[model samples]
Target: MRLFPHPFAALVVLVTLGAAAQTPSSPVGSVSPTTGLVLRDDVVRALIHESSGDRIHDGVQRLALLARDNAGGYTEAAVWTKAAAEAAGLKDVRLEPMKQGPQWRATRGELWVAGPQRYRVTSHADLPMSLAIKSGSFEGADLELVDVGTGTQDAEYAGKDLKGKVVLTRGHPSATLRRAVTKLGAVGVVSSYSTPPWNLPHRLDGDFPDQVGWAIVPPGLVPEGQPAPFLFMVSDRQGRELRAQLLTGPVKVDVHVATEEYPGHYGILSGVIPGTRAGEEVVLTAHLDHYKPGADDNASGSATLLELVRTYTTLIRQGVLPPPVRTLRVLWLPEFEGTREWFALHGADPVRRVAHFNFDMLGASLSRAHSRFLVSYTPDWNGSFVNAVSESTVAFMNRFNGVAYPPRKDFRIGSVTGSRDPLDAHLDRYSRGSDHQLFNDHGIPGVAFSTWPDDTYHTSGDRPELVDPTQLHRAAFAGLSSITVAAWAEGPGALDLARLVAVHGARRVAEDEFRARRDLASAPATGVAGMHRLARAVVRAAYQRERDALLSCVQLGAPAKAVRTMTQSLERAEAQALERLDADSKARGVSLKEPAPSEAERRARAFVPRRVKGQELASFDELVTRAAPEDQPRVATVQAALREATTALRERGEGELRFYQLPDALASYADGKRSVADIRDAAYAEYGHVFPVEALMDLFGLLERGGIMTTAR
Candidate 1:
């Protein structure tokens, strides 16, 4: 989808006009606490404008604006929070600063790439200043700027001694260049532009891995500053002219840089629209600040929260939602740190009843152009709640003006056993590039609204200019409706019932499938009777675990017996599988069973799994061999898809997918299948990771686009 910025002129005006004149409304069911009323529009506009206006727009701008004392200990973030609170008319806003670790400088200039194939450098500052040399030391090197025109790696730098020297040439680098660089023991490598103007300056910026000589030039030997190393470019006419001058002497250049650090804060800007119920609270959250302007990244989310607060406050004034069953709290946090602090201070128990509606980047439809929808990462246990909430929100959005509301393609449900799914963008290292990770981690029933990741990300260009006010309104309305309906629906009673039923059903399915498959596979005349029995045992064990997870998700009312039975079933299956495998190994006279548990399984059980990547998993053949060696070919196809699934996995790094499915992919693949490909494909197709091969390829391309993978071939 071609992502473009949505103009916010209308919403901006509405918000500005409302905040400046009207008095803010009191909490729901409360008397006239204050003798005034603030138009919801104005408050919304003011909050957005206050957070993202001018150079101080949406960033943790240093306290220079609010207070001039640079060394006064008040950080830009502190001042900004204070200002935001005052603008929202929040009471008792505090500017507390948390001491982050001291900053560490890049001790040496570096050329950092995804891996070691020194392809195109995409970062702005790091590339240009870095010299292209592989890891290891450069004792001494020298080479000339004679462009060998367009030719092979050997022909290009051949006849010329590049040993202990730098070589510069143009045209796409080949495996030969890789070998040449290795063979000649070249001290430096530089990619030069024969063209006149550099269109993308950011493309040329990167670090010189180990403080190597960093220079970019046309193919020419410029004048010398010393007995300089190699400097060259393409054999274009311009390069030839420069080399003629360079034979006289090689030019030398030196670059240096210093870095600075900012102390961070573990704080969030939060206010409560308290519910009439004493214990219940509903959370409407969006991250307040970011490292960049983060328009679609999260400014859109902050805006959504402000709009919802305004809408909810208005509802209270109109007595439409009097004395809500759960209090509504809006929080603008500093990602995980703020959330951790908040949870630590307030406790997560109250948040249990608290259904969360998180507004994240809802402006840019990254891949789903003019398309948006609610995503439910709930387990099968609370499938009902997931369904109701997702469906109701979409319905609400549709009612909010068909034009403003984009049609949702479908409800997306995912599971990674217990980690994030790779297909989800919000499950990244940053966890949806917002603060939703906290609530999801703590088992709170919540959903996040975010636009797809665009090109902006953490760059300076992620500004309000890209925001779509209408998109913002529609998403916020959907979020508000979901929360309101959930708040009014008593509690998790219905969901609990559904969970119980699903768990029971899943267990039945698992047992029936296990017995049927095992009996059939173990029939007397099977060709590979031993293998069949083992496969049956393995399949039964896998289903038992899957059913156990389903039970965990199932909301049972005092189904302790059912839960216990599920657990025992899984344990029994695991023990039997291990025993059978061990016996089979002993029968074959091979000590396949290490006596001790395999480290991978042990770690999978105890340690949380990290996200899977190309380097993280075994090779395709190895993976397939592990899954089902007897079905190697089919498995190889699947493994190829999985290895190429790097891009898909990365995309799913947003939101809750990173927390569950993405991490779980490793475990799913670790299932005792002899074929990694079969295991991956089966898990993906049967579970939720399935995608078209082309889609997988596209995703892989995105992840490895300009980056290189340095795996042992």
Candidate 2:
């Protein structure tokens, strides 16, 4: 039994009700004369000035003030905590406070570039050496300081007697020279640079030992009387002559810098919507603070949560939704630590909750501007129910809005989505990177709503004027729909009671299986093998027993819950196997290893399907012709999957690898627009058979990846 209905029938309803489905309306107002919603002129006018609209710059200013006024740049964080509490009007908006140590500490002498003699001497204020001087008896060590050209990877450093004395370097690669200098018995080295360019690539290896003086010296590295170091000035002719000469020369060295430490708190603001039923809870989440204005980066998400609360409250008041059967808790955490503390305090409720809906950076206009798409981040195939909800939300948006969005590319999602793959798949891909991570990590189905900045993300220029409010509305609508649907789906009496019980029971069984296989090391190999054999037999028997039941229910239209339960059961079986292996290995004081694959499994894993080249499947004649068969439900699923995959693949411009779509490969193949054969051929052409089916399945495994394509099977 499938939860999805027939495609032809669904398609008609979709076409006719597309606007209505995508854009929900207030009872007071109707859609425009053409398409989509039309707020009453008064209402539209009011929204223009609404605080919830797009007050990003204001929020950013607020953040800046908070950072500046508070100790350790955390007072701004406290302000956010307060704002979240005040916004919800909940005295106990789950305010949890935890301190984060100094984000950066300077230990070495400060290096500076005035006109650039490339100085390395000590500071006027008792500053440390720019480079730790180590002199091992040079015995008559008549030493002179030397200047290596700019420290670019290709910069030449060959023109000086750089032994037994100090050396000054130009840029980044200076640090790489420390050991070599030590080997050469050079007393010291100084790497210097002027004020940086507008943009700086985040270097992963920025930190170094304090002994080496990885410092920031002052503007007086060049003496007031002396000319600047050779090749320091950047006149056009100078640059050309230097380029021609590849200038390298001796330079006096001076080092100076001051360091300090400050303490601050990373706070998370949380609120709760008490539930009516026992043992059920739902959490709405977002992060409340950041280092920059973070408009689309996050100010949008924070604001989205604010508006969502209003909408949810309104919907509740209007009786559009039932009183929540489960507890509904909203959390505005200070990213990771705040979430961790909440989990510690609240215990395991997150995992046990009905679901979680997260709002983070919901107003990014770039996706829409460039691609007319809304992006979502959910868990990978190895994800859980929480992940499914995230994926489902995106699908709902697409279906309701009748808009095309990127398919769930595991690799792409994995990157901007943020969390490490394999280990963090179940957690918010962007969680550890942002705030949704803790809930997702605890097994609460969670999703991150973010609009990545096109040009301005964390910069000072992330002003409110740059934000697109219409896009915010779209994100809000999408988020609201997901929350509403999840509430209905997970709420008591929302679906057949028996089916829910079956789903829960089946999930437990799967967990039990996982625990078993996960502990294989604790049992004898023969017994473990026997248990696996029996497990498969049990699964076969269970399928046989339930197959007819499921098919009959489908034929009789028993209910949607039945399909959800059956699918859940299969998912559980797989989960159980993995868990069993993990648990067994742990019990035996050993770790479970990735299983050696047979040829078929290896081939399946190795395959990388070719995505549609240029045109969208909706635009392709063959796809339309293939899609014409409206009777088969699988066609819709396959087509939707291909549509998303193709769109995402194309969006990834050259010079960048697929990081978001992790474990990169085609997953399961069904003929929507492209057949399994076509996918296999594509993979053969692209990556060969080293790609595995499991990898592909994992890529497309969870529902969160589906975004708007949730209607697909």
lDDT of 1 by residue, 1-713 (tens): 73754568668878988765464332211111121111123332232222211222232222212211121222444455456544644434454444454322122333222223323222223332232211222233123333333325456665776554444444422322444454554444444332211112112212111112222222212233322232222223333444464566653322222222334334456776666567767677766544333455555665555545555555555444444556766676655566666666565354445466677666653333333344444332122233333443453334323432223322111111111111212211122224554454444555667654243433333446544444454455456545654454332432333343344345444543454344434434433443443344445534543554434333322255654565566567656655554454445543332244354334323322222332322222223324444444544443456545545654544222332333223332332222322333334422334333333322222222212112111
Candidate 2 structure quality by residue, lDDT tens digits, 490-573: 322232323422443354445434434443434565455434433443333333323333322232123566565675666566
Task: Indicate the residue-level lDDT of 457 in model 1.
Answer: 36
Q: lDDT per model, in order?
A: 0.40, 0.40
Those runs of model 1 whose alpha carbons end farther than 4 Å from true positions after fitting are 1-96, 103-258, 261-266, 344-353, 365-376, 379-387, 395-434, 491-661, 664-713
Q: Estimate each model's TM-score.
A: 0.45, 0.47
Which residue ranges in model 2 land beyond 4 Å of their true spot? 1-52, 55-61, 64-71, 99-258, 262-264, 314-323, 337-351, 367-374, 380-441, 457-463, 488-493, 496-561, 564-713
Estimate the overall C-alpha local distance difference test score of candidate 2. Answer: 0.40
What value of lDDT does candidate 1 attain over all alpha carbons?
Answer: 0.40
